[model samples]
Target: MVTSTLDRASAYTAAAAVLDPEVPVLTIEDLGVLRAVQVAEDGSVDVTITPTYSGCPAMQTIADDVATALAEAGFGPVRVATVLAPAWSTDWMSEDGRRKLSEYGIAPPSPPSPTTGDRRNGPVQLTLGRRPELVACPQCGSTRTRELSRFGSTACKALWQCESCHEPFDHFKAI
Candidate 1:
């Protein structure tokens, strides 16, 4: 009994459902990290992924997760490929992904600026009035928080300490 291409495609979809280990709330698809899935004529599955950040250690784990999921779905040979050309951007994050990140206690990236002038100045500068409020404490929703470190458990996040709750948490750095 051989599986049809459609069946394999369905399997690929299912296999890709596994969420990122670091941020369990978002699946690779939601993060726009899962670039492509190809099922060869011989039943081999190839999954292409672009990491959210270069040199991110989690990419290996994510690849392994993809391979494991495909194998469990009865794909005899699974190939996980990393593609780096286009580069991953927070802009690729989906709306659902943003909601999931916030629900998971991390902030999501803000929408991109409308003009290219926003980028020519090294990093975007926010006028005092236009500046966004400090990220609230994810555990308690308290606005009384201070940045403890620019880098958190991951490069994409920053460590913050809640003055009200006295707890340390990660804030997804606005890219």
Candidate 2:
């Protein structure tokens, strides 16, 4: 069935509005997780999304939310598909998403290494193995922040505290 441009736009708007369960401040669009939206004349909609990481606990919730958003917007038979081929990276995150993260008191992820293309494939390194690079604290803008834990409230984030402000915050990890 041929899908009208209007239908496609509507479906995209609905799906894009769905927020990440882990980060309420940023919509899936902002996170760059909402990859594509296709709509049919019958109102069926298909959405393609990539998880922040494979096995990210929020994937299910994100899919469900996307389906719900489309259904609520009068788009039916919603199908949310996951793709892992081009593994998601912090580089996919929008500038607005990064700004929102900082505004929410969470340190935004640094840009992926330019030489490595973000290292989205092959063996994943779990350890820093060296002095962690300085991450400025979102609260005080202090570069003297220390990582409190490798994992934070979510797998995509790490716990950090500022030495200057003595405030604790989450730092979105660059993947």
Candidate 3:
């Protein structure tokens, strides 16, 4: 079936609405993983996404979800592409996504340092060189949180405990 630009926009919207497999509270668009959704005049859809981590296990699931969502939205023959050149950053996360994450009991990614500037928009920042940013506790909203472990319940998160609430929470590490 032939599709117009308006249809393409709708297809993009559909695909972008797909939620992250690991974190259901946030959509791919919210997580900034749904990079670009392009629709061809022939009604084919192409979705570009970037993984939070290169070895992220949910990448396949996210791709599948995107394809399924677009197909269900009446867009056919979807192709999902992954791009890692510019790398994914916590900075790419949307403000609404951050709020959703916080509401979901997961600390959202902190903003990139000013020095980093628009550097987050291009190239990749080495994790080893990155200083761990201070994280606020979702429960108590306390900035006085201590890292319990480098790894949390998920690969992308770190385990932290709030001094005020004394509650353990997952912090979405800034990358």
- TM values, all candidates: 0.76, 0.89, 0.93
- lDDT by residue for model 3 (1-175), tens: 5667788789888988899888899998898887898888787888899999899999999999888998899888999999985788888889999999999999988766686655447876566564756789999899999988989988999999999989999999877
In model 3, residue pairs whose N, Cα or C atoms come closer than 3 Å (at least 3 residues apart or on different chains), thus clashing, are none
For model 3, give the RMSD to the true fold. Answer: 1.6
lDDT of 1 by residue, 65-151 (tens): 989888887885888899875666666677889888878878666645474233322543435443444677777878898888878
Q: Per-residue lDDT for 61-80 in model 2, tens only? A: 99999999888998899999
TM accuracy, model 3:
0.93
TM-score, structure 2 vs. true: 0.89
* lDDT values for all models: 0.76, 0.87, 0.86
Stretches of candidate 2 above 4 Å error? 116-131
Q: In terms of TM-score, which candidate is stronger, 1 or 2?
A: 2
Colliding pairs, model 2 = none
